[model samples]
Target: MEAEDFAGAAERKAPHGDRGGEAPRTLPREQLIGRLTQLAGVGNIEEAMRCLSEYVGASRFMLARYDLLQEQGLNFIVTSNWPFDLVRKISGVLADRYSRSTELEKCIALLQPSFEDLPPECRVPPGMSQRYCSLLFCVGRVRFALLLLFPDHMILSQERLREAALLAAYGASFVEGRSQRNDRDFELTEREVECLFWIAEGKTSDEIAVILGISRNTINNYITSVMRKTATKTRSEAIAYAVRNNLV
Candidate 1:
């Protein structure tokens, strides 16, 4: 059940549709599952991430919490092996894109994996992955991302990355209490929170008003207040703020 015990415990399936590495070092599927089942009990995120890193053949990785409303800011970065300058260069670009993306798109992309080439200034070792395989996950209303850097030119199984994403999310829950230490002084009322909850669920303002037994104008006012309190410029941004802070 200890995190240390999981190191080198999970078997890896190489890219190209076949195994080519020293297969003896890979841990079996059953053991991997059993270890994941015990993930919640493993309290240190770095140790947990290291365990996952070994399985993926990742040279390094970064686990961070993102607020889609912010142009550039991580609520907290649980752990990362990324070089400092590299993080500084990429963070703003990443946040801006996240902030600009529509709510519908953000919802659809949740827990879905993506791969992107690293910035030219950021170079990895020859055998390291040139592309970053990123995955976003949510807990309550907060969103987190795991950017795992595996080996280069090798086609990693998406199925395996998905499992790592799930496991990393579970492990990160214990880190910083999953953004619980963030600001909660928004003073959103029960009604406002209810509207935000429904809004995040894809409800139209009119639809929410009807469900909450209120006028459309009232629903609009609640959302407007939320935007003001969160310093967001739009309704979509307000909802994104709620999601980032786990308020919804």
Candidate 2:
């Protein structure tokens, strides 16, 4: 490394044209990694939604979990933004329409973002307004959609859009992984999940027996089986797992 060589290299450095004479703002790769890993550690849907809303500088975000089938299809769980009734109404309409778009369908299939021009055929319901949006990404098993909303004509930077789409993928991964964990978190049968749901609401085994129309001994046996299957030594631990896994 000669000093002249170093001087020539420095001379070759171009002015940052995009920054108006200032240095270009940069996020450290390590910082991005930490942010991503933090998102990955997110335990469930709500936390994932909160992280994404904050990350993308959005007023709110919507996470709609669906199951795509031919008939009686598209069951949804929408979190974030709008009243419950609004979410329900809007989702019911949008799921079928959005799923039918060749572009949106392709985006979901590829797990990629597809930017759409707005006032799209997938129109926003009465209360929402946006001129454009990116489909972001979807996770198939959960059949989740990540839609970002902003004021009309607010152009999203390519870099930011890429970051948001990447974040959506991570969000989807965390959600899917947590659901899989919940599926395995209990060794309990459907009956046991029902029992735990009631017990977590402060019902006793006797109360649960009455609710399920089973005998007290049968209820006890179910509880024991639940504890064994969930690998929880006590009711408290089982409940803790339920709470942690969002099963209740």
CA deviation > 4 Å runs, candidate 2: 1-33, 39-44, 66-75, 102-104, 107-128, 132-142, 180-248
lDDT of 2 by residue, 61-172 (tens): 6665433322243234446664455444455456556556564354454444344334334445443443333444545323455655543322234444456666667656
Worst 10 residues of 2 by lDDT: 8-17
How far residue 83's Cα lies from its native spot in candidate 1, in Å, is 1.3
What lDDT does candidate 1 reach at residue 227?
Answer: 79
Instruction: State candidate 2's TM-score.
Output: 0.46
Mind giving the per-residue lDDT tens digits that candidate 1 earns over 138-204? 7656677777776544445556666777777766665535345246534888898888888866689
Query: What is each predicted model's overall lDDT from 0 to 1?
Result: 0.66, 0.53
- Model 1: residues >4 Å from true position, as ranges? 1-20, 23-26, 33-42, 68-76, 174-191, 194-217, 220-248
